[model samples]
Target: MCEEATRRQVGICLLCGLPGAGKSTLGRSFSATILRQRFAVITYDKIITAEAFHLALQDELDQSREIPPSSALLKTQETSQWKQHRQYLLEYLEHLIVALLNSSELRPPEGKCDGTWYRFVDCLEEQGLISSAGSSTEKGTHSVIIPENDEVCLVLDDNFYYQSMRYEVYQLARKYSLGFCQIYLHCPVESCVLRNKGRPVSIAEDTIRLMDKKIQKPNPEKNSWEQNSLVLDSSQLIKADDHRIVKLVNQAMANPLRPLQENLEIKEKDRAITAASILHQADQSIRRCISETMRRVKGTASAHEMKVAAQELQSAKSQFLEDLRERLCEKGIQPMTACNATTIVSLFKEQTDHIVQPFLATEQSCCLEPNLDCNDRASGIS
Candidate 1:
């Protein structure tokens, strides 16, 4: 589905580079270089504060952990929360984009909308997105004013060092139905580390080295966003008028990208994921049972009474073991091997096996509760 837009110039510019690679500089200067592009800049550095980010991540994790058992439960929980978070963030970004598009049609009071353009910048500023440096004058007053252009753009600045980072921006654009492209600023690691040193709050040399290792250069062959992307050699000066950049910008203006989301497709995927999770949890549960049995066996310390009781408990659960295999096969899961299933079933029965041991030779009944106080009989304390 294509996002509805009234202006031709509306799109997203994602500026990605290492620390000290001039991302901020490019973001600040992007609009001025284009003749008719009205633009705003959103620096990721400001939007994601360390404390806020950590707290947010913790909340996502906590919420995810509440999900019921399934395959890769922890991993699935994390993935679900992240997708939800991205969708929410996309909604938030759409509000700003809508406000800007509305502002483009601004006129005098008689023809005016409910509020003025100030509300637009004010709302964004509160969200930690500042207007581009040159866009403002007289102490941040005129930052939101545009040059009466037919279209406007928003530029995102960040150390988009990973392909996943860029992918998020691409997904956002698709969701909003906007034209989107990335400008990959490539610089030598040595140059970036040296550049980082001059910053007010410098990054450690080691951190820069590690970040360099993690950086993923775009490949149009593997990523659709890269097809329209530009690679700027930030190791040297690149002009806005550079042929490659101009071509990309003009192409976007002429034909902005549309979104691709198939709800039906996703619904089917979710079902499969749910099934996998259920099966995975069931499998893990079996292993846990085996481990618990092993613990019980070791805890016995070779007590003769406990061993006899354990054997009795193991015998009592024979029917339960038979049913477990049938249940797993119904769900298309691999039926447990005879040896493996027996090993797992042995654990739960081990504690029960000793119920008769304490009574033996003392006229105690063999029929005792499976969950009776094991400590009174065979936890092997004696």
Candidate 2:
């Protein structure tokens, strides 16, 4: 009848902010306070450093390799390579999740991973989340142990400055129907720079400042998927027993993300409704313009003249409506309200004047010369 006995709960917790924003500090607090669950904190900096070192060593061993001409160009290339390594880290985490879910051996897919994959595996082994499946003699045989208590949390500690980087993890959670949440460690740029100076492995102050400007903190109002997120000011010391942090994690684990599905039927139905609404509004606006135009010219023309002008205007309206509908719904050339009321009325009046101008002119000619027949004048022209 307990929570764990029912089903194992697994989730991803992202700790993201600027360097020295105390994300690692908060993650440790979370793991210590959150009871009756298995927790593993994956520190991205350590793995990234290992990968960078490997690349550096490779460059050193291969001295014949060509180097960039300028230091600026070299720095840019290094930044690009680091981005690739981050991508590989995400892929490695994805593979680990799959192995845990399937209760299978943790082996890299053929040609899908690089040196970063082994470092990731080593991190997991260090945390006791995975163990060697074969004897100690085997180098790469490993398997994930499904937690007995049915609750597991993987806290990813990194300076995920871009929304897209966090989105990748969200997608992974949705793919596996796992709970997902984020924690943003908010601190002044000055405070972060000061804190970075105190760490044994201090990052460059300029790099920390640059990341502070680039960091995109979680916004639930803007992004519905990031609803279960917590923001704590890392300038102040965070306690292990923070209520807000605890509540955020509990809510995420309670409601896991649903797997993605393409609902083509719903999408088609929505398109149909939108098309109908657009046409209906256009038809109503065009009809109102026609009625207003007729009212203005009512007393000026004879009844017969009015009747003839009305017929011509109705024909023009039909042609305009057909064109409008085709442009809006069929070809998707314009938005529903792209042509405002004033613009529509002005365009319709132009067509209306063209259609009814002859009638008004003919009527005026008949008034000036009573002896001449209006019918003869009209018939003789066409």
Query: Candidate 2: where is the Cα deviation over 4 Å?
Result: 1-7, 50-69, 133-139, 146-149, 267-382
lDDT of 2 by residue, 20-66 (tens): 78888877775568455577788887788744533432333233345
Candidate 1 structure quality by residue, lDDT tens digits, 1-382? 4434443457887788777787877766665585465566766544444333333333333443454555346445555544444444444456566545555322212222222234444545554434545643333332335443456667777776668867877776676567787788998989988888887756667656766766787889987677888888898766555677667766765667677756988866775665455445435544455345434445444577556655654554554444444454354443333333334433434544455434434432222122333323311111
In candidate 1 the C-alpha lDDT for residue 90 amounts to 44
Worst window of 10 by summed lDDT in candidate 1? 105-114
Cα error, candidate 1, residue 282 (Å):
28
Off by over 4 Å in 1: 1-8, 50-91, 101-149, 261-382
Clash number by candidate, in order = 6, 0
In candidate 1, the residue pairs with backbone N, CA or C atoms under 3 Å apart (3 or more residues apart, or in different chains) clash, namely: 70-277, 71-277, 293-347, 309-353, 309-354, 310-353
The candidate maximizing TM-score is 2
How many clashing residue pairs are found in candidate 2?
Answer: 0
* Model 1 quality (TM-score): 0.49
Q: How many backbone clashes does candidate 1 have?
A: 6
